[model samples]
Target: MLPISKPDLDAETVYTTCTATARPKSVRPQLQQLTVDLNDAVARYDTAAAGEGLHTLGDLQHQPDGKPDKQPGIKKPKPKAGGLNTHLEAAYTNRLVPEKSPGHGFYEQLMAKAPDGRCPLCSQGVADTLDHQLPKVVYPLLAVAPVNLVPACRDCNFHKGDQAPAAAADQTLHPYYDHNVHDYTWLVARIIEPPKPSITFHVEPPPDMPPTLAARVRLHFTTLKIARLYNPQAGPAVRTLSLNLRRWKLPSSQVPQHLLELAEDAAVENPNCWQAALYTALASNAWYTQGGYEKPWR
Candidate 1:
């Protein structure tokens, strides 16, 4: 998880946008009747989200043992035919946030905060869309709250879709509030060889960090399948390093030193980034830096 600065936009502005052009007939009567003031509704929604952040989204049905059952963490024993979720999905996501609509500009405005336009979740992919910290289906009032929206890459967003935290322990890092990724040495990788060359990633938090935070790191990686997603990409990155060695006419004997320098440069940019973690771990491994490393293909 990468720490991202929250967007400067406000909930009132976004909520107003959603409510402004919504046709009376198009919006559900329940929302119009109950939510007399959009501003108060947004405030209440933000308060609820702050409370929800204290707990992890409950286990999906099969995960009664306190573990999550699948990617994106939807509630177990999924919702039946009809209710508020169904109504909200239709009114909020389908109608209000549609392309070229009045509410769409707010969405675009929030997504523009992503640094380098890269998803802060993985820091490797494009920040193409936004993830609601408190899902829209579960909390319709926050459907367009700027603070609830998090810019993310397609894969990270898909894997984390609509999942709510059941307890504080299960809550994955919120890009805005969770600053561990910015200052901690959490993600680490190792080079794999023998049959082939590959890399594997894992969470290894320092001992001083609280146990709860370390657990969240594990849960985040598990929920997002970060190891599965990141390892394949690391191959190309490692091969590029090998290519650089050959291009510069540097011997394999100097690979360790070169990789250490590369990792240092990356660490200076963002210390906990997956790329930085990869280089740091590679430089520490004798096998990887001393000629076991090889490019699999062109």
Candidate 2:
């Protein structure tokens, strides 16, 4: 996961802004009353996230094991219900998400924070939507909380829909708070030979890393199906590398060194990126560097 800076805007400001233009004259007072709850929920979320205790938060207890979309015949809460969860969810879907809404600028502000418009969760897909870290349907109080929203691609958001961690180890890495995970090289890849000349990615935290942190990294990799997302893309990359190697007319003896240089350059940009992992694995593999580039990237 790519680490990003936490939003400077606070929950109260966003909550008040979103609720300021609530439709239906009667619901205005009720939406206004929820401001304090939003503030308290944001505080709890910040504290629990920092302590790795978000799974223990009261709101999580109400989250169902599976999402409505995934579960057959499960219906989502109606917007007209006007209940607490519905109201808050609408605050997001109606007030914050719509293009003409007063709080729509904040939505753009959050999306703009994505590094080069790439989702931090996968660092691959375009960041076009805001995903709730704690799931707004379950933790309605944080529906408009700035810190609870993460910029993500639609695929990442769909893959992570309504997932509530059962424990600290199960929690996916938070970009804002888990910056330390990116401080070292934990993501690595292995070169597969023969039948299929492909590489697979996985997490390999350093020895000095704490066990909990290591578990979190593994879970993050698994939950997002990172290997599945990256392996197919590696095939085209290998084909490109082979074409480039031949185009440059580099000798077999120089292939490994060239691969190492590429790995170093990729690492300079992102230590844990799939490109860095792929090049590092290829540089160490004997067959891949010594004439293995001739193999058709099946």
Candidate 3:
């Protein structure tokens, strides 16, 4: 996923928008405390270097799974039964819908700022949900924190329900916090030969890469189902797309160590060639897709 900038919104606006439901008196104090904590976190984040600290205010703890942990403590405090606002309920529900129809302005705004008009998670044409980088269930106080919101597709939203981030050395690339992601190229896609009616794909991590980058690549592959066409295998459409035969067919030894650099230059010299090269690489056999090819001798 491309890195994103933090949205320009205030705490009061978010609280009013997200907390329209009535809750118990105990909930009020908890909510207020959360609000204050989030505000302070944001203020600190504004002045820090990129990736200096966890950008969101969610508490970090170990979860059952080996992923980065979050724990949403306490349930909603009981509110007066009749005190909930019907209008607010409607508004909130409308915002939560997964489709990219004419209803939700919040989802639209988030999608407009996302990279390539695609949700990073599902590769869906439109991103209609604002996902929390750190799940709201874990950090209820930061539930409405703008810095935590990310544009996501419905499948991803459902699959990632309240789960923690993958536990690697570096955090998952927060679209807002991590800016240099484009600079790193760790995973490559490739096709598998002897394809049957259905397409098959595979993702491979570059050799000797950092644990965090490898984890991110694996997470993306799983989350998107990049190889799902080979069902019971894993991954989704992009994986199959990688298997298309019209792509690259070269030897690894011939490929240069600085291929990405050359590719960047080619992009500047001839954008079409750059696109072709990338597409070719993606469409090659699973081995080539993951490991890449050596340059050809003319």
Best by TM-score: 2
Q: TM-score, each model?
A: 0.77, 0.90, 0.57
Instruction: Please provide, for model 1 over 1-298, each residue's C-alpha lDDT reduced to its tens digit, 9 standing for 90 to 100.
Output: 6676766776665555565444444444544443444456555544544443434322211211222222355543432232333433334564445787667777777688787898877777889888877666555555665776888888888888766666677777777767654567777887676566677888888888777778888888887777887777787887887777767877877777778788888888777666888888888887766665654533
lDDT of 3 by residue, 182-246 (tens): 45454343433332222234445456655566666567657656445233332333344334322
Q: Give the distance in Å from residue 189's predicted Cα in candidate 1 to where it truly belongs.
A: 0.5
Q: Report the C-alpha displacement of residue 28, candidate 3, in angstroms.
A: 5.8
* Tens digits of per-residue lDDT for model 2, 1-298: 7789999886788898887776666777877876776667678888888888788786533322222222235676455534555666778998888899988999999998999999999888899999999887667777888998999989888888787777888788888788888777998999889886778888999998888889988888877787888887888998999989988889999999999899889888788999999999998999988888877878
* lDDT-better candidate, 1 vs 2: 2
All candidates' lDDT scores? 0.65, 0.82, 0.47
Off by over 4 Å in 1: 23-91, 94-96, 251-253, 293-298
Off by over 4 Å in 2: 59-73, 80-82
Evaluate candidate 2 by giving its C-alpha RMSD to the native, one decimal.
3.2
Model 3 TM = 0.57
Q: Give the clash total for candidate 1.
A: 11
